[model samples]
Target: MNQLSTNWVLGHKVTPYQTTGNYNLVKGESPAGAQGPPPHIHKKYEEVFFILQGQMEFVLDGRQSTVTAGELVNIPSGCLHTFSNTSDESCLWLNIHSPKGFQSFFDAFGVPESEKDAMQQSLAAERITDVLKRAREFDMEIKIP
Candidate 1:
């Protein structure tokens, strides 16, 4: 069995799979009260989220929906979407990006879990310029509205 490597990105503990599958699989745990990435759109891939435990509030295209364990949601390519753990407990979920490749974004911007403290310091020290630059490289556009 292959051990999945975990990274801490924007308060989420993400474990990405390394299989040569059609889609990239990332399991993420979001702490209570944590907000996910800002509403963003992926031009090249569709994203799906499956709630494994706890609950999540997903805002898709300006509509808000609360999903609980055993539920799932899909955001098509080019759709604006974001999610957060609004419940009192942490939320465990699986994120899938079709046609693969999106994991590169996490790899480039995320910090390994072991170095979370350093990552937080670096994030605070660095400006958004680096993140925006990297997002462009991954075909993701962060929407301000």
Candidate 2:
């Protein structure tokens, strides 16, 4: 398990790669009131989110819905989607992306929990900007709103 800290509220546990170019799974946790990434669309991959703990509010293609533990949400390619922890407790969820490769985005922008010095180095290297600049290379498009 590779632990990733994307920010104060978002944490990710990346499962080891088992098959190349097939799929990627990431276990994610967010504190209450935490907001996810800005609405975004993937041109090449389909994404699925499974709620494992608290509730989350998902906005998909301008529609908002609440998903609780044991529920799942699927966002197809080219759909705009984002999610947030709406309950007053931390929410645990799984993010699965088909056709793999989305893990590369997390690897590039997320800070490894055990590597504090690496985090600092990444920060100094302007990782977020780099992520935005390189997003298309991973078949992702981030929308600003």
Best by TM-score: 1
Estimated TM-score for each candidate: 0.90, 0.78
The TM-score of candidate 1 is 0.90
Instruction: Tell me, by lDDT, which candidate is best.
Output: 1
Candidate 2 lDDT by residue in tens digits, 1-145: 4444343212333333344457887777776776666688998999999999989999999999999999999999999988887678988888889987877777666665566564344444365577668878877788988
**Candidate 1 residue lDDT tens string, 72-118:** 99999989998989888999999999988898887877777787483
lDDT at residue 95 of model 1 (Cα atoms): 91
Error of 1 at 104 (Å): 0.4
Error of 1 at 26 (Å): 0.8
